[model samples]
Target: MGTTPQAGGTVAEPITLSTGETVSVPLSTEATVYGAIFSADRPAVDDLLPRGLEPIRATPRRAAVTVLAVEYHRIGDEVMTPYDEFSVMFPAVEAGERSWPFASLATHGASGYVWYLPVTTEPAKALGVDVWGYPKEVAEIDHDDHVAGRRTTVTADGQEVITLDVEAPPAVDQRQEGVSYTVKDGTLLREQLTLDGRLGAWPYSGQATWELGDHPRADRLRDLDLGERALARLRFDGEFVIGAGEPVGTV
Candidate 1:
């Protein structure tokens, strides 16, 4: 038998970048996550993956502030249906810090947004979009025709950046596997699911669009008939940081 090192004792090496700078990252698991980030689902430009760079221990110069969209696609013998799924997590930087104003919105069926300020001047408007949550799994009837995927498109002044990525499944066909972000111009999109071989192509999807209106956050959603059933059961836990820092790294 071979001896395996303890989990915490296993440290990942640092990676050198083209700009002569380096970053060190700590992986939540031993599995390689970079491969999923660079795969077809979340494609990256050439040199995007620095030489000897690995996600296990790679840290960006700045924290990432992104708007991610998780969409699920279900393929069936006769019908193709899509659902919106989401999960929000603060990175290591903002884990224990005070919650700031990050823009946020949630719709019942499709697209939504979380607008965060990262920093604020007024104390009264301290906690921006205090909580947010998304569905974990999109269900499937036969396990074969079901597929799920997500896409996170981020833009600043309508311009795109190249650092953020979607956490997608490595392979497009694996039943449990999902594709992470696919970067085009500046958007990161990912989808996961199993194809029953019924359709020749992917079906149209939906997004949960959320924004502030005349009423409060709760009332705003109600006006649109979004998620009137289980509003209380929704679990949205995350915080925003407002300061001088970069949201995501640049290539």
Candidate 2:
């Protein structure tokens, strides 16, 4: 393991990856996220990726799409205050693990890649873009919790990017957890997350729509040629937390 200089002359813990590589990462931020997931066939979108970042197929070419709204309660950066994030992601696992989604129902440790990450503050954008290499930008985001579940929207310069509505039904106590992947410092990193609250979530078929706006980055969704029909929709109105990302390996 290698060390990265931390604040106050202390060294941050070096994370070990499955391939025996190591890297230092930001470990201070802890958040509770409220989110939903949808899936669809996005062939055009799959072509733009580099090696080892291919979409995990649910069917032949259908991929999972996740829409998330996050709340950061504990963090090291206060300037990124009012820490809220609106994220869209897909499961892009190892090249050979293209069948990852098949095991999603049986395992919770699968990882994916972030398709789009837009936060509410400038400092947050800096960390996301500069440090994490995520395509995060500053945008106007709003949240509403109603009887159905949660509704989240993203807008910039008065133009809407996307809108999400989900429902968390009543049921027995339950929990769902998973990990998302990111490439940081030339090493693959896995972000651990868990959702615990309302267990009975309504599963609906084909529910997400994307209005890719004029924002250069936001509008990139056009390349995906995403079909009008979503694959599935999952509702979650529970407590979710993300742990410090762990190093896994290179792509």
Candidate 3:
């Protein structure tokens, strides 16, 4: 594990590989819980925006294709705002490759959502999306104060997939919580995640695997050069807060 990054800046920390080799590098901006989606060959219908693309404005234009939301913590650059939102796009008809999603620790006051809309409603389901909730300063925990539930699907055509559901306790308990991960085939392949604690315990211990048949959006994603990159070889650890999402007491 490495020291946290400074706000709006970078952090160089030592990381250990599975083989126990430790090296230090500037933690990637994408490595945090909050940040933008950086993709290759993103499509731009406007054709006039720089790089053949346009900055995502406040309009609901039909151009977005991926979104991720997470919390970030640090003390750095004064010019930029801390990561509270994230979005990414794919070039029209083009695919993405070797991309990483965002991650990070929640701030005392943080909350928002991320979204990715391909804009076209064809059979291609050529859309990408991610979202994050606000962050709040909360206590930590040890062990599993959270119970895990899962939703598995084997589509009519035999496409198998599973989604995990984790329920956080009413009150947090620090000391017994650690970040846990669900890997595929005992290898580092990005699957699903359920975490305990604030913004520090993630990518915990453990692994889970799965296989999928050809998907409907496969071609489009391939054209865009997205999907199936493999969670293999990718690893991270930290926990984040689900700030502002906790419910009020019952009447």
Q: Which candidate should be chosen as best, given TM-score against the real structure?
A: 2
lDDT of 1 by residue, 1-251 (tens): 23223224444233333333322212111111110111011112111322221111111221111223323332111112233322222111111323221111111111111222211111111111111111121221111111332233322232332112222232332112111222222322222211121111111112222222232322422232322111111111111111111123221
Badly placed stretches (over 4 Å) of model 2 are 1-34, 72-80, 98-111, 126-131, 206-212, 237-239, 248-251
The candidate 2 region of ten consecutive residues with least summed lDDT is 102-111
Task: List, residue by residue over 1-251, the lDDT tens digit for candidate 2.
Answer: 46555333445554443333333444344454444445555575476454466676655656656666666664442323546787777766656653555455224222367767888877667665554556777888877777755677788767888766655444555666777766666776667656565444334444434455666655566555555554444444445544455766675
TM, every model: 0.18, 0.69, 0.22
For each candidate in turn, give its C-alpha RMSD to the true structure in angstroms.
19.7, 6.9, 19.6
Best of the two (2, 3) by TM-score: 2
Off by over 4 Å in 1: 1-7, 27-154, 157-251
Which 10 residues in a row give candidate 3 its minimum summed lDDT? 123-132
Candidate 3 TM-score over all chains jointly: 0.22
lDDT per model vs. reference: 0.20, 0.58, 0.24
Evaluation by lDDT, superior candidate among 1 and 3: 3
lDDT of 2 at 238: 46
Residue 166, model 1, lDDT = 25
Alpha-carbon deviation at 217 in model 2, angstroms: 3.9
- Rank the models by TM-score, top first: 2, 3, 1
Model 3 agreement with the true structure over 84-170: per-residue lDDT tens digits:
222222222111212123221111011112112221111112111111111111111111122331112222223312111222212
